[model samples]
Target: MDNQVRVAVADDHPVIRMGIEATLDDISFIDRIGSVADSTQLVALLDTQPCDVLVTDYAMPGGQYGDGMELIAFVRHRYPDLRIVVLTSMEKLALIRGLMTHGINAVLSKADDMSHLRAAIQATRTGRRYYSPRIANLLKALPATGSARLSQRESEVIALYVGGDSINTIAEKLQRSKQTISTQKVTAMRKLGIETDADLFKYAIELGLTRKKPLSD
Candidate 1:
């Protein structure tokens, strides 16, 4: 396929990688070059087999290189020419905004259908930005937090805490220190004017921070 849009995908879940491959296969202009499980492998693949577009999960575990913002930063720094389309389960407005600053061409939530992914890829190929409808709505609905906006990490910590995960659990899940998680929790609470756990949970629910939909949906 001459002038085909070469694509590489990185996702820890085999089912997700297969699904993305299958989705891209339906597009005649897209060529599936490589599919890997972690950010380290994705970087290695990109070094050897460069692609025009990279579709990756934001929170892929089991890699020497960290996932989420760190992985996105690494890709943006090392592969500046490679267009990135993030297909993630994370719908946090702060996180999406952070990814946008890191040169991500598109952001699509896993809750959305494959049509959004297709649109993102096509738009990215033309040097345009695309956000899934769900993500777009979430971004639009982000409420201001006090005098300063919440950072992505702060929002993540708050979301996990509000979802009933303890500070220790959130620390472990995010690969951060307990103190760091606690500090973020405190900072987030202060910013959102949440004085108690009940208030925080209610606010998180109101903002749709909890992951209600199954990943397979």
Candidate 2:
């Protein structure tokens, strides 16, 4: 077993937190020194006893770009030595590119295998960079889909929609009525030649809106 490496985890869902912690428990190299649900708490903890590596959710409560970007910016400005790897259900290449431009140490999908996550964490901790195969493949494939145009709002709604969030939940989160969210989703789907939620979800994965969810019982 490797020496315990100070680690921090941030995710919105309790189940996700549990899963991450459980995985780390199996790896002696990870100590899981801290955990938080949102960006605010994550930032606060870092200000006091920042861990060797920060694993954060891509998006968080309140719409202030509280995603990994905010925390990444803080680390860049205040704690330049800190390393960060964004673990997210989001597949958007835009967010990945944004993180890269902001000095994020690495980006990994929650859907990736545990080996990939471990490798990324270890690599980033040593000042090396690692982007998962999904991210690298997405970046390479982004240019091929030039004809599909989706507005920013559509993109946001679709991401939530594909990430297993109900339409009502998305509407509530976006501060819009269910009808509006439904209409926009239908319009976006039609424009994209999507017929079912499965198709919509597939397009989202293809467009890098959300990472593919693991199939498990």
lDDT of 1 by residue, 1-217 (tens): 3879999999999988888889999988888899999987988899999699999998897887778877877888888889999988867655665576577769999999877777898899898989988888876664466336679999788777766688998999999999999998888776655667766664454345654442431
C-alpha TM-scores of all predictions: 0.66, 0.60
Report model 2's TM-score to 2 decimal places.
Answer: 0.60
lDDT of 2 by residue, 120-212 (tens): 889888878888888767666644332256677887888788777888889989999999999888766654545688766655553445667
On the 0 to 100 scale, the lDDT of residue 156 in model 2 is 80
- Best candidate, lDDT-wise? 1
Native-referenced Cα lDDT, model 1? 0.80
**Which residue pairs overlap in candidate 2's backbone?**
91-208
Error of 2 at 98 (Å): 0.6
Q: Candidate 1: lDDT of 96?
A: 66
